[model samples]
Target: MYIDASLFMGMHAAVPGTRQACASFFAEHLRDRVWMTYEEVGRCDDVVWALPRDTQDAYYPFMDVLHSTMPVKRVPYTEDAWKTAADLPGRGVLSLRERLLMATVIASDSRLVTVNPRLLNLADQGLPVAAPENSDGRHGAFPEPLAGLYRTSLALEIDHARI
Candidate 1:
């Protein structure tokens, strides 16, 4: 599953529960490995770099350790993904970052996991997406309902392109 920036930001949240939830999400997905696009990763890095110098110094090591210890799988932002981002089927609704992220998701054939209402709306429209929420407030596993949704969405995109 693809990890979105929101969830990624949650990992560093000051709220203990939020941090733990993000940690639990990573632990649960360790075996399968969590995927993230290069752009998203850079965005996270930028968040860190934008912090006060002392904070950056303090968190840099922590961030390094986390990256080294986590089960993260980096997804390259390839030309195909760039092209897809340029013409993503969001009808001018999605922001550049969202389109880039979605394009990478499509290029990698991975389901996106996010809390963004806009992206979730796309998921509601049948794109493969899963929220990291369950009744107990822990990270939920990938939903079976989203299994082939990405392919279906792609088919629709293709059909629409033909028109």
Candidate 2:
């Protein structure tokens, strides 16, 4: 399971009761299965570059947790990934970060566990997308119905902790 920045933020923010809850969730549910890309981790670090030096200290611990807990795999931007992203029909709508993430997933041949569903609809362009069934609050697993594949914010928050 490859996680993006949004999910990484959730883990970093786990505090007080949330910290214990997140720890139990990760140990029981995701420890061995979850992994993140170097690109994703770097994006988190990039946040520091945008913040003032005085504020960077406050965010460093969260960033440190992300760096230490999530196994980072360094994946380079490849021709095939760019080609796949270029082929996406609504490419114009995606931000640079989203494009890179889509491209990385394409290059890795790994499923993206994101809340964004519109990206999946662009699979016709060659990026294979699938949301986990457990991601849906009621389903506990992805259903064949397809309509409920993407998650709502509350479910995403829970799933983020699990990841």
How high is each candidate's TM-score? 0.70, 0.53
Name the runs in model 1 displaced over 4 angstroms.
14-20, 138-163
**lDDT of each model, Cα atoms only?**
0.63, 0.49
Clashing residue pairs in all predictions, respectively, total 0, 3
Worst 10 residues of 1 by lDDT: 154-163
lDDT of 1 by residue, 8-126 (tens): 66655555555456545754664567888887788777666666776666555545545665578887778888887876677678888888888888777878987565777888677
Q: Which segments of model 2 are wrong by more than 4 Å?
A: 10-30, 33-38, 52-55, 116-163
- Candidate 1 local lDDT, residue 15: 55
Global lDDT of model 1? 0.63
lDDT of 2 by residue, 1-163 (tens): 5656544444333333332333233333433455556677676566445656545655554444434553455566667877777655565677766777777676777766543445556565665554333322232222222112212211222233322
TM-score of 1: 0.70
